[model samples]
Target: MSVVTGCASCGDERAAGAAFCESCGRTLATGTPPAAGADCPACGTTDAVGADGYCGHCGRLVVRPRDHAETAVATVAAAVTDRGLRHHRNEDAMWLAARDADVDAVVCDGVSASFDPDIASEVAVEAAGRVLASGVPADSPGGLAARVGAAIAVAGAAVAALASTGDPRRAASNPACTIVAACVRGREIGYGWVGDSRAYWIPDEGDAEQLTEDDSWAAHAIGLGIDPRAAAVDPRAHAITAWLGADAGPVEPHTATLRPEQPGLLVLCSDGLWNYLSDPVEFAATVRGAVRKESDLLRAARALTALANERGGADNITVVLVPIN
Candidate 1:
């Protein structure tokens, strides 16, 4: 099988599975990730800002550690990095933490081409998380759809408003980004995403399959009869047709709930991390090893990043690891 290699952020082709691009220390095939943001969980009413990793209201830590007695231990790990191999600075950003999995998560990949792309990503992640936390109104079929539609429109509008504002990161044109968020509560799971960043759930015991498809030009080409292998090789594969921001053309998204109960590990990541670690078996092995090392959830996040970095830190890699028992 062909391996994954090259600078996902810059699109430099190289050896398959090669660690870092010889041209640059940048881990190839890995894309830029969103940066961490303030925790704005809806359920977290405590004065503790969820973003600070604690409960301001209760004056207690917000992130609950692994307590054998408190339900099954749910482990979450993640890391974000940007070296700006070519650019003056890295604009990618990411948020990975337990904001009440039941409440869901928010991930946004901003467009580096635009000014303050990082801020755009931050705005998107926070908006999605807050919306997911706020209770969706009680609705029937039409009501539910209409409510969701309105919420999405409002999200777009909110993003636009930020673009107009003069935040240090904001510019005449707002950066574009792609976001994917998933909510897991017990056996029930709901997911939503705008742009191409993805969400994947691979059973700890069963098979590994990607739950989301890329919204990239190459992915679209594959749907039109081109071979995925050839499509992958296309130089234009790097060209993302959609995302969030001023340059982002439209705002279409994917939303759904899992059928039958899903019991396994939940993986959410930016294109950077997924590009190099696409194999389901390998992905599972990495997570399992991290847990076995007696490492906490945070360690689990570091272990994976370490692996990528060891291989040759290529691109900005970011991941959220959630263990569902």
Candidate 2:
């Protein structure tokens, strides 16, 4: 067992067997325990310490899923969304649904500046995921572009509707979030995005390319002839100009399509994962390395999240991976 030398709250020297500060009654941030202690958070007893990170006394998890979570949609698709090391709670959300050769995925990042941003992300992701999973239009003239556009439109409407009642808590700022949704049907891929969440096509060889353009101030400035590195490192680099919310006038998603020559991986992720590895070449190499280490998409997803955290995860991290067969 590791010892906590001092209580950060009261600056009092900690005594053995004490879980909380004697002076302030504040719980100690004892860091992660190498072994499960006899003290159980739920039952407050020493007889229920389980090695599985759960309370044997009350069947409660000492660690919650909100801290970290993972989902495996299929053998070829998986995703991981994490609260990250610095964030208190995860505001990013992701959904992946696969049917035969079709894979639908959505990732939303809550705008921290807005009220109830987490709610916005959840609402937007769910709305978009539902629409995408409803199946593509087989005979529609719009094809993949129309399908993706429709899903994003529905998601924007869902977010806009949240302000109809106007909760007092959010009077200053309505809930807002950025979205990136995509559908992979056989070899064809269609993607759409609002704000900074991005989609990338990483092949087994050649180069990887970003599919969606960011709807942010920095990206806009770069489009106007600013230096790429200079624009990305500017103070307002992440100030998103487009988002889904009541205050946002309109949610217009930039859409794209890609048909890769070689089968590889399609990565849909929030900025949290790519912020650390913004270089396309480096990002592609890291992704390929992770895949080579673990063929399973679930494991590869975990590896990418782990890499983000290792590089100092300052934001909620979300990643969704779809393997092209």
lDDT of each: 0.54, 0.77
* Clashes per candidate (backbone, < 3 Å): 23, 0
Residue 70, candidate 2: how far off, in angstroms? Answer: 1.3
**Residues 77-174, candidate 2, lDDT per residue (tens digit)?**
77788878887667887766655557778889999988888888878876886677565573477677668888888888888777765687675688
lDDT computed for candidate 2: 0.77
Task: Judging by TM-score against the true structure, name the best candidate.
Answer: 2
- Could you tell me which 10 consecutive residues in candidate 1 have the lowest summed lDDT? 64-73
Q: Which stretches of candidate 1 lie over 4 Å from their true place?
A: 1-90, 95-103, 137-155, 166-173, 259-262, 293-295
Q: Which segments of candidate 2 are over 4 A away from where they belong?
A: 1-64
RMSD of each: 15.9, 13.1
Error of 2 at 266 (Å): 0.4
How accurate locally is residue 198 in candidate 1, as Cα lDDT from 0 to 100? Answer: 72
